[model samples]
Target: MKIGLFGGSFNPVHNGHIKIAEFAYKTLGLDKIYFIPTAISPFKKKNQVAADNDRINMLNLALENFNYNSEVSLFEIKRGGVSYTFETIRYFKKKFPNDELFFIMGSDLLPKFHKWEYVEEMTQSCQFVVYKRSKNINKINAKKYGIKIMNNPIFDESSTKVRQGQLALVDVKVNNYIGNNFLYAKEIIHSLLTAKRAKHCVAAAEFAVLLAKSIKYDAKKAYYAGLFHDICKELDENESRAFISQFVENAYDRKLFPNYKLHQLAGALWFKHIYMNDDEEIYNAIKIHTSLALELSTLDKILYIADKICDGRAFAGVQKLRQLALENFDECFKQVVQRNIDYNLAKNITFSDEQNEINNKWSK
Candidate 1:
C-alpha cells in the first residue's frame, strides 16, 4: 500500500490545505492520506496555535466533503510535547514496514527541511512530495535533498487572513465554523467601548451593510469597518496619541483635533495591529469615519454615512440623512461634509490639514 503523510500545525486548516492534499492524492497515486495535526510544532512559536481539540475539529470539518481517502490522526496531539516529524515517521515506518510512505509538504518548507530533527533518517524512511507555495526564489536546492516537486495549483488563501475576517476566501463550512465559535470576534472593539458605544457600533454595522448593498460594495467588509470604526473612541488620550504617533503618518497634524475626534485614525491602527487586517478598504473606512475625505471610495462613503445615520444616533435631521444616503451616496456625503464643517466653524474648532484640504475642495 502507498500512503502519504501530511503534517502541519494546521492552526485551523484552510482551503489551501485541502487543495494541496487533493493534488498529492491524484499526482502521487497514494492509497490513503493521513493528516497529522501537531500539538506543538518545533518550528513554530509556543502557544501560537489554537487548542489541540479545536484544531482537530476544524480539520475534521474541512475534510467532511473530501472525496479521496483521508483520515486525521491525533498521535502528535496525544504525545503532549513538541512534535518532531522524524518521530512520527519512525512510528509510521514500523507500523507499515512493507508499505511505501511519502511525506507531503509545501515548497516553502523545503529551505527549512534540513533544520528538522534527524533529516537523514527521515529521508531514508520516506520520499517527500512538495508543491509550490509561492513564486519566491527557493533558497534550498531540492535536488540535493532528493525531494520531488509536484505540479499543483497555487493557493493564495491563508489561515491568518481568514481569522482576520476575510471569510470570502474559505470554504462555507469553515466560515460557518468560525462564526459559530466566535473565533475572530474583535474583543478590543467590545471591551474598549462603553455599552452605549457598543450599541452604536452594532447599529452602524447594520446601516453599513444597507448602504454597501445599495452601492454594490462588499457588505461584510463594510459591516466590520463600521463595527471597528469606533474601537479607540474611549481609549485613554495618552494611549491613543501614542498609537497615532507611531503608526499613523502626519501625527502632528492629527494632534490638532480633540482627543475624542482622533479615535478614527487610532482605531484604524489598532485594528491593523490587533486583527492583522491589511484590507485597505476597511482600514481607510475606519480612518476616515469621523472625518469625511475629499475623495472617498464606495466603502469609505458608506461607513462615513452609516456612523451618522445608525439607529443609535439621535441627532437632528438624522432621518433625512439616512433616506438621502440610500437614495444618492455622493449627494448625501456632500451634505454630511458640509454639516460637519458648519458645526466645526460654529465651535471654532481647528481642522487638521487633511480635514481642511477636504473642506476647501468639497465645501463649495
Candidate 2:
C-alpha cells in the first residue's frame, strides 16, 4: 500500500491544506494520507503556534468537510518538543515497513529541504513530493533537486491570512470554530499593539478564562475583555484625550482625567465605536481595568486580576497571586488592588481623584 505523510504546523488548518491533501491523494495514488501536526516546529516560534488540541481539532474539522481518504495523526503532537521530519519518517517507516511511504511538502519548502535534519536518511525511508504552493514560486528549484513536484492548482490561501481575520479562506466549520473560541486572539491583538504588548494581552485573556471558569462566570466574555483591555494603550495623548472627550460624558471632571488612565476610557469607547459592540459588561471591564472600582462585578474583577497576574507580567508575588486567584478570588482581588496602590505610593505616582476614591473604598 502507498501511504502519504503530510506534515505541517497546521496552526489552524485552512482550505489550502485540504486542497493539497486532495491533490496528493489523487496525484500520488496513495491509499491513505496522515495529516501530521507538529507539536513545535523548529522553524516557528513556540508562542506563535496555537494550542495542540485546537490545531488538531481544526484539522479534523477541515478534513471532515473535504471529500478525501485522510486522517489527522497525533504521533508528532503526542511526541512533544521540536518536531523533526527525520524522526517522524523513521517512526512511520517502522510502523508500516512494507508500505511505500511518501513525505509530502510544498514548493516553498523545497529550498530549505537540505537544511532539514537527517534529510538523506529520511529520503531512504520515504519518497519526497512537493506540491506547488503558489503561482509566484519557480518550478526550477524543485526540478533542480530532482524531487517529484505535483502541479496542484493554486488555492492561494494561508493560515496567516486566516488568522488575520480572513475567515473565508478556511472551511466553514473551521471558520465557525475560530470565531466561537476566539482562537486567533493573539493575531488580532498583535496587529494593533506592539509585540510585547500583544503577548501580554493574550496572556491576560488566557488568565481571565481561568479565573472566570473558577467562579462560573462567562469565560468568553472574560477572554474578550482581557484581550482588548489595553487596545488603546499605545495611543498618543492627544488622540486618547480626543476619544475620552467625545465618548465620556464626565470628561470635564479634571480630577478623573489622568493621562495614564486615558486609554481605559478610550479603549472602552473605541471598542464600542469601532465594533459597535454594546456589551456594557466588556466595555465597563476595559474602562476600569487600570483603576479598580468600588463594588466590582465578577467580569470586572476577573479582567483586573488577569491583567495583573497574567504570564507576561513580571513582579514580586505574581506566582502567589496567581495561586490565590484560582483558590480564593476575593483575597486575590484585594491583594492585587493593594499591590497596585503600594506600587503607586512607592513611585510617588500622582493619584487621580478616581484612584483616591477607589483606594478609600478598598481601604475601608
Candidate 3:
C-alpha cells in the first residue's frame, strides 16, 4: 500500500501541519499515513519539551476528525534518543521494503536535505514530496534530488512562529473554526462590560487592528488580540506564567523564542478565563506575539507594533511611525522597528534574536 511518513517534534501541532497533511491525503491519493513525532531531535538544542505523553496528547487533540486513514507511530518514543529522520527512514525501510513510502517535508527543509546524515541512503530509499511554503515563494534546483513539489500552498503558518509569541489578526475561517463563534470584535465588546481594565483595551485593540489592517491582515483577530493584549500585564509574574501554562500547551511552539511579558499571551488566557473556551488561532496569537514573526498574522503584528505607533501614546519619534502607518506600510514598519533597535543600541539592552531578525528582514 502507498503511504506517507510525516515526522516532526510536534511540540504542539498548529493549523498548517494539519492543513498540509490534509492536502497530501486529498491530492496524493494516499492509502494511509503515519505521523512519527520524534522523542527528541538532535538538529537543535533539545526544545523545552513537555512530557512525551503530553506532546502525544496535544497531537491527538489536533488530529481528531480527519477522514484520511492515519495513525501516530510510537517508534521514536520507544527508541528514546535524539531523533533523526535518516534513522527513522531506515527502520521504516526495513519494515516495508516493497511499499511506496513518500516523505513529506517543507520547501525550506529541502535545501538542507543533502547535508543530512546518510542523505544518499535516505533519498534513494524513498520518494520525496515537497510543498511550497508561501504563495510568493518559489523553490528551484532542489528538484534534481528527486523531489516532487506541491503547488499553491500556504506558507508562514509554522510551529516555530507559534512558540515565539507572534500573533495576527485571525480571519473569519479561523473565527468560525473556534467553535465559540465569537469574533475578536465581539470579544472586545464583551471584555469591556466585564473587566475594569477593559477601558485601555479599547485603545490597545484599536491600534492593533489598525496595524493589522494596514499590513493587510485579518481585521477581526487583530482586534481581539489587541483588545486583550494588556489584560494580564497588571498580574504578577507567577500569575502571568500560570496563565501561559494554562493556555498554551504547545511546548515546541512556545519555546522557539523567548517569552516575555507580552500582552498577546496574557490576552489569550484572559479570553479562556472569561470565555471558558478558545479558538486555537486566537489562543496561539496570544501565546506567541512577542517573538516568532512567521505568518505575520494580522493580530500578531498589529498588537506587537501598534502598541507603540497609536496616536495617544506620547513617545519619541511617535510622529514618524504613526504618520507613515497608512501612507507607506513597509516604511512605517521599518521605522518602528528601527527606532526600537536604535533605542536598544543606546541603552545597550540585549536585543532578542527575534527583534534582531525583525530589524534585519524589515530594514533590509
Candidate 4:
C-alpha cells in the first residue's frame, strides 16, 4: 500500500489545504492520505494557532466536503508537545513500515527544510513531495535532497490571512464552523471594548450580517467591520491620537474631528495594526461608518445603517429603519443618512461640507 502524510498547522483548514491534499493524492497514486494537525508547531507561536479540537473539527469538515480518500490523524495533537517533522515521520514509519511513505509539504517551507530536526533521518525514512505555495524563489535546491517538486499551481491561501478575517479563503463549511464557534479573532472584540459597547458591537455585527444577506454582499466583511467599528471609541484622547499618529497616515484632518468621531479613524487603524486585518473594504467601511463616506458601496451603506438601527440602540424610528433596512436597502440607507443630518442639525452640531454632500446625494 502507498500512503501519504500531509501535515501542517491546518489552523482552520481552508480550501487551499484541501486542494493540495487532493492533488498530492492523485499525483502520487496514494491509496490513502493522513492529515496530521500539530498541537504545537516548532516554527509558529503557541498562542497564534487555534485550539486542537477546533483545528481538528475544521479539518474534518473540509475533508468531508471533498469526500476524498483522506483521514485526519491526531498523532501530533495527542503527543502534546512541540511537533517536529522527524518525530512524526518516525511514528508513521513504525505504523506503516511495509507501505511506501510519502511526506507532503509546501514550497514556502523549503528554505528552512535543512534546518528542521533530524532532517537527514526524515529524508531517509520517506519520499518528500512539495507543492507550490507562492511565487517566491527557493533559497535551497530541492534536487540536493532528492525531493520531488510538483508543477502544481500556487495556492494563495494562508492561515494567517484567514485568521485576520479573510473568511472567503476557507471552505464554506470551514467558514461556517469558524463563524458558529466564534473561532479566530471574533472573540477579541470584547476584550478591547467596554461591556455595553461590546454588546452594541455584536448587535451591530448581527444586523450587518442581515443587511449583507439582504443585499447579497459578503456577510463576513460586513460583520467584522460592524463588530470592530468602535474598537477605539473608549480610548482616551491621548492614546487615540497616539495610535492615529503612528498607524494612520493622511490623518492630518481626521485628528481635528471631535472626540466622538475619532474612533472611526482610530478603530480602522487599530483593526489593521492590532488584528492584522488587511481587507480594504472592511477598513473603509469601519473608517467611515460613523460619518458615511461619499459614493458609498453596498457594504459601506449596510454597516452605516446597521450601526445606527441595531437592536441595542433605542431611539424613535429605529424599528422602522431596521425594517426598511431588510426590505429596501437604498431607501433605508438614504433615510438613515437623512436622519443623521437631522439629528446633527437639532443638536446644533456642525458637520463638514463632505458630510452635507453625502446627505444631499443619498437623500435625493
Candidate 5:
C-alpha cells in the first residue's frame, strides 16, 4: 500500500496545490494525499503573515471545491514551531508503517536537502518525488539524492503565484479564514443603482477584476465591490439624505451634499441601513468614487475611473480618458480631477470638505 505525504504552509492552499496532488495521484499511483498546513513555519514568522486559523479556513474552502485533495491536520500548526519536513515524515511513517511513502516537492527545493535535519537518514526513510515547476526543465540529480522525479505533476505554479492571482479555478488559497468572506448584496443593492450608474458599477467590477487578475487580487471580492459601488444612487433625495445624516452630522440635508458626490456616501449608508450588510470594502469604494477618491482599493480605482470614462458619460474628453485608463490610471485620474475643479470654478459652486479632501489626496 502507498500513501503520499504532501505538506506545506497550506496557508490558503490554492489551485496550484490541488493540481500537484491531483497530478501526483495519477502519475505516482498514490492511494491518498494529506494536505498539511504549517502552524509555525521554521522559515518565517507566523504572525508576519496570515494566522494558522485563517489559512485553515481557506483550506476548508479549497477542500469544499476539491473535496479529495484537502484535509486538515493540526500536527505542525498546533505544535507551534519551525515545521521541519523530517519531523512530519517520521510521524507519518509511524502512523502508516506498512505504506510506502512518497514525499512530493519541486526540483528546485531538492538542493536544500542538506539543510533539512538528518538529511542522510531521511532519504532512506521515504521515496522522494520531485516535480518540474515553471519553465524549469526536468533535471533531477535523483541518483545522488536517492530520489525520483514525477514528470506528470510538473505544473508551472507556486504558492506565490496563487496568492498574486485575483482568481483561481482549483486553488488552496480559499482557506477557512478567507472562505467565502467576500461581501455581497442580493436584491435591493442592485435596484438602488441607476442604469447609468449600474453600467458604471459593472464596468468597475470588470475593471477591478482585470486589475486583480493582473496582480492576483481576489476577483470574487473585487467583483462584489464593483457591483455595489453605487448601490444607493437610486434612493430618493430624502432617503439618501437621511442615510448620510447619520455619518456626516451637521444638520445637513441631502441638498447640502453635492450631486456629483452625494451618491458615494449614500451608497455606503444604504447598504447597512437596508440589508444589514455592513462592509468596510464596499463602504470604501462607495465613499471614494466621487470627487477624487482617497487611498483607493483595486475595486475603487476601477469604479472611479469607470465613472469618468463609462460609455454613457458624455463628459468632455471621455474617449481620451477611457483610452488613457488602459495605459495611465494616474493621468486619467488627474484629468478627471482637473475637469471637476475647472467645472466648479466656472460655476462658482461651493466645495465641501469631502470634495476638498479628495482633491488634495489625488494631487499626491
Candidate 6:
C-alpha cells in the first residue's frame, strides 16, 4: 500500500495542481492521493490566501471529476496555526506506519527545501516527489536527499492570476463555485454604490455574460466590466466633479452635463487607479458604457447593450432591443444608440461635445 501526500494552500486550486496529481498517480502507482489544504501557509501573507473553508470547498469542487483514488484531508487545517511539512509527514507516517509515503511538491520549492523544519528526518520518513516548474532540480542535491523528479505537462497558472478576474483560466466547476459563493466579490465598489444601483450592476453583469458568450469574448471580464460600470454613479455632484478632475483632461467640460452622466468616465478611472485593473478592454468598456463611441470593441459594445437591456431597465422598446441583441448584436447596438439620441432629443437633454461628435460621426 502506497500513499501520496499533496499539500498546499489550494487557494482556488487550478489545473496545474490537478495535472500534477494525475501524473503522480499514474506514474507512481499510488493507492491514494491526499490533498492537504493548509490552514495557513508560512510562505504566504495572511491576505494572500482565501478562508480555510473556502479553499477546501474549491479543492473539493476541482477534484470531483478525478477518476483516481484521491481525498482531501483537513489535518493541517484542523491542527490550526502555521502548517509545517514535518508535522504533517510525521502525523501521516504514524497513521500508516507500514505504507510508503510520498510527499509531492513543485520544483520551485526545491531551493528552499533545506529551510524546512526537520528536513533530514522528514526526508528519511517519506519519499519526496518533485513536479517540474520553471526550474530544473539539481540531480546531485536531489539524489543526496533521495528525491525523485517527475516530468509532467507544465501549466502556467497561479492563484493570484485567478483572483485578479482571470476566471476563464480555471476549470468551469471552480469558476461556478467562485461565482456562487461570490468568493472574491469586490466589496469596495459594491459599498460605494446605492442599493438600486447595485441591483442594476448585477443585472447588467448577467446580461453581459450572455452577450459575451454570443461573440466568443471572455465572459468573466465582461461580467466584471458590467458589474463595475456604474460604480461612481451614486457620488454627489461635487464629489463626482472632484474625482473626475484628477483623471480626465477636460474635467470642467464634464460639468456641463448632469453630474450623473459623468460616472462612466469616473468609474473607468476608479477601476484603473483603485482596483489596479490593467485590462484595457475592461477600462474601455466602462468608459463607453454610458455614451456611444465612434469605434467600439466587441466588449465595449456588449457592456453598452447589456446596460440598456438588463432586467432592471424598463423603457419603451427595451424588450425588442433585448431580443435583437441576441439575434443581431451589431444591428441591436446601432438601434440602441439611435434610441438614446431620440430620447435625448425628446427630453431636451444636453449632450457633451464628445457625445455630439460620436453621434454626428455615427449618424453619417
Overlapping backbone residue pairs in candidate 4 total 0
Model 4 lDDT on a 0 to 1 scale: 0.82
Alpha carbon lDDT at 253, candidate 2: 62
List TM-score per model, in order. Answer: 0.54, 0.59, 0.49, 0.57, 0.52, 0.56
For model 1, residues 231-304, the per-residue Cα lDDT tens digits are 78886777778778887566656356566468887888766655556577788888878776777778887887
Q: What TM-score does prediction 5 earn?
A: 0.52
Candidate 2 lDDT at 289 equals: 87
TM-score sort, best first? 2, 4, 6, 1, 5, 3
- What is the descending lDDT order? 2, 6, 4, 1, 3, 5
Model 2 lDDT tens row, 79-156: 999998899999999999999999898888877777777777887778989888777665554565557878789777
Better of 1 and 3 by lDDT: 1
lDDT of 6: 0.82
Report RMSD (Å) for each prediction in the order shown: 13.4, 8.2, 19.2, 11.9, 15.0, 13.5
Q: What local distance difference test score does each model get?
A: 0.80, 0.83, 0.65, 0.82, 0.65, 0.82
Candidate 6 lDDT, 219-307, residue by residue in tens: 99888988889888887777777888886666767455455468888888877755555678888889878876788789988998899
Question: Model 4 over residues 1-364: C-alpha lDDT tens digits?
Answer: 8899999899878878888888888899999999999888887854577789999998988877665678899999999989888999999999988989999998878887888778888888899999987777584657778888887878888887787666678877777677555577554566656789989999999999999999899888888888888878888877777778887554446445656668888888766655556577887888888877666777788889988999878889888889988899998988888888888899998767777786788877
Candidate 2 lowest-lDDT run of ten:
137-146
Give the range of the ten consecutive residues with the poorest summed lDDT in model 6.
180-189
lDDT of 6 at 13: 94
Q: How close is candidate 1 to the true structure, as a TM-score?
A: 0.54
Residue 175 lDDT in model 3? 26
**lDDT at 79, model 6:** 100
